[model samples]
Target: MDILYTIGAVLIFAPFIAFLLVVLIARKKMKYQSIGLAADLTTFLLFFSVPVSIKAIWEIDITALVYLIAILIAIVLLVIEWRQTKEIEILRYIRQTWRMYFVLLALAYSSIWAVGIVLSLLHFFRI
Candidate 1:
């Protein structure tokens, strides 16, 4: 239980670190794609597990379900991207425009973490 929160908390930073690494050091390489993908998955799992822990200790919030669905969507997108293994039309275009993909994921994941921080603080202070 406590460990779940700890892992979840730690995982919350994974995506940010990955994003920063990609933007700062690996911006010129295709490796950013794998790093971003790993970060996104970590972010998804963090949210997914946190909600489960919260539910075990307290009543489940509506927002938990929303987060679960969002994680599922993220996972689906990752799978769709992964299944482009052969790099056909759309996949080839996506691979070619990897920068665009990284930018969008960065924006989305950063905003998610930002909102989570705000909401956590609000809840902590009972504001």
Candidate 2:
């Protein structure tokens, strides 16, 4: 149990490693490049990990806030799709929503790391 938690913590803290591992595993099964598939998987992984990472770095849990933002974005996208096409395409909507979440979460993950690095530097310098 402790080992499992340790591994989980490592993966959560180092999502790039997780991403690379996914790509490597996916490549074994795929003849073509697996970057896209790996990215999608990493994005899904980020959806869960980003909030935890943010909490760890900032000492605040924003899981509910993050989820609420995703939902709101999806709802807005759905409305736009409905207005443009005049019909709801479930499959397309789902794909678009997923892509949007990937972009959103990826940006959040990068921003969190950047801010964390800055904070660490400031603390180290006693700034």
Listed per candidate, the RMSD to the true structure in angstroms reads 7.8, 1.9
Q: How close is candidate 1 to the true structure, as a TM-score?
A: 0.36
lDDT of 1 by residue, 19-111 (tens): 455455654665656566554454454444444444433556555565555556555665676686645466644443444444554565556
- For each candidate, give its TM-score against the true structure: 0.36, 0.86
Q: Write the per-residue lDDT of candidate 2 for residues 1-127, one digit (tens) a residue.
A: 9999998888777777878887888888884557767677777778778999888887898989988998999999999999999999998898788878888888889999999999999999999
Model 1: CA > 4 A from native? 1-13, 19-92
Clashes of each: 0, 0
- The window of 10 residues in a row where model 1 has the poorest summed lDDT is 48-57
Residue 73 Cα positional deviation in candidate 1, in Å, after optimal superposition = 14
